[model samples]
Target: MSEKNREGKRSARERLAVEREKRKAADKRRRALIVGASIVCVLALATVVGVLAANAGKSGKSSASGPATAPSGAVGKDGLAIPVGQDTAKSTLTVWEDFRCPACQAFETAYRPTIRQLADAGQLKVEYHLVTLIDANLRGSGSLRAANAAACAQDVGRFGDYHDVLYQNQPKETQDTFADNDKLIELAGEVDGLNTPTFEKCVKDGTHDSWVQKSNAAFQSGGFSGTPTVLLDGKNIYADQTITPAKLKQMVEAANKS
Candidate 1:
């Protein structure tokens, strides 16, 4: 080949090599940008999740003053309803509930039988904590009213029966039916001796209103996120997704054995 042709070929080869290197560098930059963007997205998502978790924890905590004083006949000092079992029961089941919460109603309806049986059998003591989250969310007084009426029932030595009746006759979440004192008295009639003049007076006057507020504050301080939060011997039963309504009896039995 001629010298001039050889030189031209060499220059062409060099140009092609340079172009290939440029393309490789460009691809590297694009890949780097893509990786960096993916990492940023992941970090942002993690931050959001962390914030949400923190908020949830904060929402669950109870107030500093703790739960209100238990009513005259209530079993515990913290305004909880009278426990249904013997004082030496093997397990303590603490339930945080809202009268207007559908989930709370569902839990009551589904687990009432098991809970009642356990209590009656003296295997466990069930403590009820009334909260007013629904009242705050729905802008109604039903939750507070119902809780107050329940406390009145406690004063009359019929808290458990009245509590069950309240759940059995719970109004729809959107309806503030329990807000009516007459309705509360009517429901009280379901539990014998709970519809007396004094009981009616208590409901009408919201005698336990302050107690209900303290109960809610206690619930917040408890670090519970929502209604029907159940604790077995002070440990959260629903925390790990292992316990369900059907498994509650078994869990109680296990706790008793343990």
Candidate 2:
């Protein structure tokens, strides 16, 4: 081969080598850019997830409703009324009621004395469960607010007195009067020593609102359909046609005898 042709061929090969190196460098740069972008995207997603998880934790801690510390001498927990009779009583009477229910008020008015008498006499123990069904049905928060107030009163050792007073002065279900914390405080005056500043603050602040929510949840989970559901010794007395206010005492007596 001629010297000039050899030199030309060698130069072409060197040019090809340089071109390959440049292409390789460009490919490396592109791959590095892609990897860096993927890492940034992953980090951003992780940060967003972390923030959402933190917010969820805060919401659950602040708004989750659960049991509270039971009042002195109370027999039950989580906003259930302490049994209002001797621990050794022969019968158990469970009542599910809503403060805003007119039927509940009627039931309370008709049978309050009998129930209190039996409980006081140590023949039966009454367990009151305050619920908020009316509030859910009536588009008002009155029932829940009143229930919360009752729980607060329970904390102050005046649940029974305050409970009767509430039923005695129950507002018309449509009126939603119990939604006003001031009105609830006014009713508290009916029960001796229940209208203290502490009580008032507890009511206004809805200190037991979470407890009320939990109690209402329990009522719903129990598969109960309505308020003023009366059970005698675990049997639903109201579900039977034969039970009446006049017969309630007799029934309790019968249950006690049995």
Candidate 3:
């Protein structure tokens, strides 16, 4: 071959090699940018999720700690339960409830009449322990606030009346209506003398929040499964689907005779 032809061919080969290397470098740079952008998007999404979680946790109030001051005449383990009916009654019914829990509300609506009759007759006594299960599970403070307000009512010897009133007017489970102090105070009008300044102060100040938190902690630690845990003389009668209001009354009457 001619020397000139050979030189031209070699130059052409060198140019092709250089063009290929440039394209490879450009492709590598584009891939690096794409990876960096993906990492940034992931990080931003994580931050957004973190912010939402924090906001949900901050609604209305926070989990309480330190010493717990219970309502007046509270009894039972750690003084967490609010007692109803005569202490001298023959049968003791223990109830664990959360105001924002739909099952608890249903239980109260179905059994309250019979329970009240039994209590008034001095045959049965009921002890109520309030917890904040809904607040923790649903991410709101209505359960905590309502429990605190109930404790406040207990302070003035009006707990039973106010407790019934609360259940009668309970809001939807998903609604955080009870979280507002003004709303709680407004509802006190349903119970005579429950709207007093002392009760109002107690409700607004969250006087029994720590106590409510303590009670909820106990409920969670005790391994019991859900709200409205009604126990009649140490038996979880609420879990027994066969039990009815009349049956409960009959059981209490039998216990009174025993």
Model 1 regions more than 4 Å off: 1-69, 75-82
Per-residue lDDT tens digits for candidate 1, residues 1-258, read: 999999999999999999999999886764344222222111111112112112111111212133344567565556455466677889899887887777776667667888888888888898888877766655666787788788888888898889889888888888878877777788877787778988877677666666777677677666676666778888877443445555878887887888
Candidate 2 regions off by >4 Å? Answer: 1-74, 77-79
lDDT of 3 by residue, 71-150 (tens): 99999999999999999999999998888776676677767899999999999999999987766666677888888889
- Winning model by lDDT: 3
Which candidate has the highest TM-score of all? 3
For every model in order, what is the number of clashing pairs? 10, 0, 0
Q: How many backbone clashes does candidate 1 have?
A: 10
What is the C-alpha local distance difference test score of each model? 0.68, 0.68, 0.77
Q: Which residue pairs clash in candidate 2? A: none
| Candidate 2, 77-160: lDDT as tens digits | 553565667788888898888888876776676678888888888888988887776566545667767777787788788988
Q: What's each prediction's TM-score?
A: 0.70, 0.70, 0.76
